[model samples]
Target: MNFYTVLEYIGMFLVFVGALFLFLGALGIFRLPDVYNRLQAGTKATTLGAFGAIIGIGLMRPEWLPKAILIAVFILMTNPISSHALARASYRRGIKLWDRSVVDRYGPYLREKEEKEGKR
Candidate 1:
């Protein structure tokens, strides 16, 4: 097979893999017990899924490579950061963790910081 044809096959495979992960992410978001867990599932899965899909599309269309790379970079940068900000906000807003959650690391750290700063 020619190189471009090989790339097309690889791109198609990646697109399918990406779609599968995206579907799984949606399922996790729907089925998870709490917002924190759902956010964790959605953020991590979709970041990789979208990056793969964008790069796959770029491979299929050589002219789109630069734009796809930029979009992938943006997703990689923003998804996790936004997920973190949302989780922290939810925790500060008095959202409770899932009943089975084992540790409370952030709560203790925040309390220490607040106590040191003398702020509520």
Candidate 2:
């Protein structure tokens, strides 16, 4: 009905949304067919889920908002980078994609780079 109370409700809703994403992310990790797919599912989900839940808690607590925002920023910056690094490493190590995967975008890019370096 009032400002803080309204924030509480919104915070609760955000927390619920965050939790739902976290759950779906887990399911994706479990059900996805490959490392790249799983990494994508996990990273994207955790970023949104964690940011939502953290910001929700910050709203509820008020005092924690700055720290919450900081943590959320860290997650936003790191999650995708880390996931990309992991996927790149896996690719370099010759991890095979799922059999039905239709594209090998990175393969061509890598070959082009290799060809250029060899020519150098």
lDDT of candidate 2 at residue 84, scale 0 to 100 = 88
TM for every model, in the order presented, reads 0.91, 0.91
Clashing pairs in 2: none
Q: How much is the lDDT of residue 71 in candidate 2? A: 95
lDDT of each: 0.92, 0.93
Candidate 2 displacement at residue 41 in angstroms: 0.9
**On residues 1-120, what C-alpha lDDT tens digit does candidate 2 reach at each position?**
889999999999999999999998999999999998999899999789999999999899898989999998999998889898999999999999999999888888989999999999
Specify the poorest-scoring 10-residue window by lDDT in model 1. Answer: 111-120
Stretches > 4 Å off in candidate 2 = 115-120
What tens-digit string does per-residue lDDT give for candidate 1 at 1-120?
899999898889988899989998999999999999999899988988999999999999988999999999999999999999999899999899999999889888988998989964
